[model samples]
Target chain A: MAEQKQVARPLSPHLQIYKPMLTMMMSITHRITGVALYGGTLLVVWWLAAAAHSDAYFAVVQGFFGHWFGKLILFGFTWALVHHALGGIRHFIWDMGRGFKLPTVEWMVRANVIGSILITVLLWLIAYGVKS
Target chain B: MNEMSNASNMKTPLKRVRGFGASKTGTEHFWQQRATAVANLPLMAVLVWFLIAHFGATRAEVIASLQNPIIALLLIMALASACWHMRLGLQVVIEDYLHSHLAKFAALALNIAIATSFFAIAAYSILKMSFAP
Candidate 1:
């Protein structure tokens, strides 16, 4: 195949070629979280399946979620979810042909980073408060 | 460089090569991805809110929660869009990083299988709990 044929050519640079910046890292983080959510969504799906089975089944799943380790996973999942969601908003804004200015890009990245953390933390707090 | 103003045109390299114009798969994939994303942005918010409300909830309480037709409908909608979006997103990931043709094909197939089963399980569960329990 032509793709298998060796040829001398200038190729795309590795990620190391460019100096890392917050916005660039945020872009990568978006993809990373997107992949993580692929697995994370399974957890939520399992919860629904278990709940559908019976109360005993639901309790087992709920117990796992109550455990510290599961909580950690849930926390990571939620962080990824929020980060990716905000990242999507940034992408949507760009897709709309706005927010292209350098300063605006910087502002959007900063807001995404902070807002994801704040929203996730608030969600967990509310969850705990409701549970208590 | 070609003096044809091709660079300024809206056609992507793949689109120009394939000559399918607007019927190109990439455009459809992109539009669908965005459509699902727009749907998810709000549906996901409502989902998180519902989850928090039911956090650490028992089966009966969770059952009672799903008893509301509106909530069940919302969950089903969220599952449908999220599954579709996830499958499309993962397909792009596979297309980008997997250089081996066989591996890329396998991954894409697996992505579809996994996304489908996940949606099936969750949707069935929601329906079962909603109508019967």
Candidate 2:
């Protein structure tokens, strides 16, 4: 049998060590919104499946989406989807080896944040506007 | 003679490390992610448009709109690509944060199963609507 030795080691610096910056914040939001999109996609599946099942089932699903809480969730889902998509574009730009400069990265992060919210609101407004 | 014998007995470092080099699939994964991201750009726009058009529409109208061949095709493509992209993205997240081996494996498997089944269900529904009327 071999004996093991104990050693003291320093741990990697974590969230407490650093101030939050726009890029860092956006990166975290990107992961969160990605996960949220998974749930949102499931809702999309539910809606499609309900429609295929029957009109009654479809109406139930529609009614659920029409309710206040459901609308809130849908709103959140829309934001998540758009945010994640923009985050992905940012990632793609990085993959292409562009936008690595601090200013460019920060600008991209800000754009994603603003663009997602604006687009979501615009989409809902359009929906309501066309509806009425 | 001694040098020849040493050379024959010793393993070249490259030979020892060859199989362990890169996973060799990192590039493929990166490309797949980027490709799907690009595809999703247009597809997502189509999805938003379709949803907006169907908003407040009656059941019959909704079905009729989905029955459009172009709409059905685009919807399925968007959903399938989204599932693929989601699975790849989540897999990276799991690999990064899930330190437990068993937990990581379980999460990866669950991710695949969920994405696959969701895509299947959505695709089936779209196909049903397109053809069953």
Which ten contiguous residues of candidate 1 chain B have the minimum total lDDT?
B17-26
Writing each residue's lDDT as its tens digit, candidate 1 over B36-125 gives 999999889888888889898888888888989999999999988999999999998998899998998899999999999999999999
Residue A102 accuracy (lDDT) in model 2: 88
Encode model 2's per-residue lDDT on B24-109: one tens digit a residue.
Answer: 45367877878888999999889888888877678787778877899999999999999999999899899999999899999999
Docking class of 2: medium
* Candidate 2 stretches greater than 4 Å from native: A1-6, B1-24
Tens digits of per-residue lDDT, candidate 2, A8-100, equal: 789899987999888888889999998888999999899889988988899899999999999999899989988998888889889889999
lDDT of each: 0.91, 0.88
Candidate 2's displacement at residue A50, Å, is 0.3
Residue clash pairs of candidate 1: none
Q: Highest TM-score: give the candidate number.
A: 1
